[model samples]
Target: MSRPALEVADVFRSHGPAWRRAHAGHVSLDQLKVMSAIERCRTAALGGHVARCADCAYTSIAYNSCRNRHCPKCQGAAAKDWLADREADLLPVPHYHVVFTPPAAVADIAYQNKAVVYDLLFKVSAETILTIAADPRHLGARIGITSVLHTWGSAMTHHPHVHMIVPGGGISLDGSKWISCRPGFFLPVRVLSRLFRRLFLEKLMAAYAAGRLNFFGDHALLADTQAFATHLAPLRRSEWVVYSKRPFGGPEAVLAYLSRYTHRVAIANSRLIAVDEQGITFKWKDYRIEGHNRHKRMTLATDEFIRRFLIHVLPKGLHRIRHYGLFAKSACADNVARARELLTVAKPEGEPTSAAVDPNKPSCPCCGGRMIIIEVFARGATPRHQPTAPTNRIRIDTS
Candidate 1:
């Protein structure tokens, strides 16, 4: 297929050199490699083939996709897989998206202790959600939660927050009946905010005491325990920010939202609008508006763009997607089955064959017949045998 009008690759190809010159002494090689990899995601940089359809004789070229976890082109499958996995975990009731933000006091320190503070963000926010929802006075049922960590804002600013997609219902404590939370709202956002603040600060202090949090570079100021304690002092004085968006329409809506977050890094490819001799332009969502129309365009220097992009490159091996309470990965499946039974809901059993029949977008290969799978390769392994038509099939060219 033809490339998009203006892609990350086009931006990199046109302006990457200028960015390198401007930031020669500043940026690291690893960071540049990541940018290059993202830009070159599904082009000739990675080899692919031109397939010819046998039925229609349609000729088309298929380029390879990067499959890099951080590449925007590669996320469709990852999101699909994750959504499928979460499908069975859905409760009969509506689901809510919960977001919790650390105070500026903690955000500064979090900048340095990304891996640590981000970990705290997930654990604390999740505990707050499940704990508050479990109260007999509230829902009286445990809630299944999937929390994703986002450490950057539209400007690539280090604004750490947890985006939690929670099923409105959960399995009973005894795993017998399906417990459901209120439809319109779950836990009170204000209450959740305070509790989240307390849990996060308490745990953060524990990390500081145990010497688990890291402080360096721009964060060197927070290294001293006294300074760190002071940094956290204001948070105790003010309430933390734990905001819950209105419940999604249903499970499918939840998947659509989760798809946007699951494989995303700091930014998405669609965000980059242009790369000219001057700088780069991007589209950023301004949540201040009433709805999605709140999003607007933004511009940044090439070097600044690169810098912001790298800020979110998570510490390697840290898991950003986490399951909690009834949705905990280890035991969620069995629990979901029991919950479905109690709710009297017949859960979908999924499609017959899941071996992604046509993983790629439909292309007209240059052949008389439609192209179908002749050989299957598990990953990059060479195909053992390929299907071929009687007339077009070439004999084994052993000679």
Candidate 2:
């Protein structure tokens, strides 16, 4: 049997009692229920049934998933569906993934403004790329960008960053031919950093003045105007960190990269190293790159694990994925069509096949093939198994 995942429900179901006892006064009852739901997804607690294929007579045990945005089990189909939708819009050009991180000094202020700061991170980074790329000296075209907000570092710390996947080029404002950037480079990191810092700071200041920002107990110092201004002063002087990765190997690489990032919650289930009475143990990547085998296993107490996991839960109704420039919803289809026409790039054919992917898609776990959708029977319904019609009785041996 394959290794089982250390699910949110696992932590909640097995360890939730300890967490609730520890945080008796702080956690609401509804919060506990949400935790339980995420933990028990795809298990018997929530219930499941068997599904049969009409064409092939193959049956599968289909367990209902939580469908919570934070559930790792649900993200696979979400990512696949999302990628399917974006496939129609892929530009026939190279694409790059860029990341922007706030410095420690700024991150202190950012901790208090997770909602606001994270939103600014998306806007500033996407806007920074578009503004710079559209310059005459640069690519000078409007680019398509899809960005995701990530708030946790490898160690489950509050390190926030934005990951952007961008098609290598864009169309000029006048809707002329597709413009391509230098093969390896997308935009200058130094330039993007400076612009991003300025744009974000300006917007932060606006949010502060509008009183959309919040300051808690220790961070109340930021509530004062002078202190807030002083806090931003050093960031103004210091160089911001806006880093860009080199262009993807090819279009397939771009899809593979998206398959990994999009719809991914804080951690994948496979990363969990162990779960026992001591607590939950999991492997995490060390980005500092001290060595190739840098993944470390760490265990935590039940309460500590719950605290760490729930800490990353975002405020309700906030969007972590955003589109900008040519990728913006208002004009993406038109712009993508025009750009494709100008570049004379042929559309990729048929559905994409992931080497191995989400359980929901049900492609051959052996060699991947279209697990054709044959039927949809209702709940508690079963098809009558009929006697096989013999080929010998019906057929003449033409061969």
Candidate 3:
């Protein structure tokens, strides 16, 4: 694929230093590290290998990726590998896409206590689903869920939400059968919403009592106990957002959906249009609108754009994707095996699952031949052997 005309790295490379100076004490260490990683990713600073095509003798330099989870340029390969690992686990049943979103008020607290609140967002949302699905009046089956946290809205604003991909059914309580839901339905959204709101608030209050929650800036008043209770009072009465989409066509469709969402950064390089004196221009979807009008271009001042992006830098070591219920790590293998057996579907053959291209063996653009690594370069070192000049030779930046 052709490189994007512009990238978040380009913006950071040009303005990051100045932005860092301007924000001085406000930026977090994780955000600073993310910026540095993106700037140096796929550059000589990370080192790489030089490859020569076996047939055409074509040569190219492919720099090493920083492999930072927040780097837009690095997620494509990561997502591919993750999807490959998960391909075998997909049940041959319809899957539902459900989203859990806290209101703006709660998002404010999440902004200040990301690690704590985001953890609750994942835990509480999963618990809510598990509770609802296991109720006798509901599906009465213990479902599995793969949840991914997304912290940015289409416009790069801080909108924390969890996207869950759930198999339409689960194993019965007795472990005797594979229980499936109605063809198009999963769980009641209203029930999920109310339970999520109550459980999240209860957990949030517990966290506050334990001093795990922090308050700063405009929320400093929330540090007081009474003030905090008052803050949460309105939220208890308000409705939280929980919605489910139509079921996917099949397991392939579910895998395709997971591929796009699993490793996505806050913004992708492809979404960037240009970086200029007028600031950064990028595509954003205004969900409040309908039809083609929802797709629009937005421009933000460089400083503001950088600030918005940094707001989404999650606390270090916090996981963005997690598995719950049957897919949980403790029993995933045995559970998947039982699920396949109950569904009466044969286990997928043990074949090579990954289709990601090996960076060390690139295809020759000229003759489609496998390229072998001719030389390795260390960090901050350039390749010693350059490709010889030939009129027909094409130079490619495989990085």
RMSD (Cα, Å) for all candidates, in order, is: 6.1, 7.2, 1.6
Sorted on TM-score, highest at the top, how do the candidates line up?
3, 1, 2
- Please provide TM-scores, in order, for all candidate models, with all chains considered together: 0.85, 0.84, 0.97
Prediction 2 TM-score vs. true: 0.84
Which digits, one per residue and each the tens of the lDDT, describe model 3 over residues 1-399?
667788898899999999999889988888999999999998889998888889988777888999999999899889877887898899999999999999999999999999999999999999999999988799988899999999999999999999999999999988999899988989999999999999999999999999998888899999999999998999999989998999999999999999999898888998999888989999999999999999999999999999998898889889999999999989998999999999999989864534345643558887899888889999999898786455864465633
The local distance difference test score of each candidate is 0.72, 0.75, 0.91
* Model 3: ten consecutive residues of lowest lDDT: 351-360
- Which number leads on lDDT? 3
Q: Which stretches of candidate 2 lie over 4 Å from their true place?
A: 1-5, 28-34, 52-60, 348-399
Q: How much is the lDDT of residue 134 in candidate 1?
A: 76
Considering lDDT, which of the candidate structures 1 and 3 is the better prediction for this target?
Answer: 3
Candidate 3 versus the native: TM-score? 0.97
Model with the higher TM-score, candidate 2 or 3: 3
* lDDT (Cα, 0-100) at 265 in candidate 2: 77
Tell me the lDDT of model 2 at 31: 61
- Alpha carbon lDDT of residue 86, candidate 1? 68
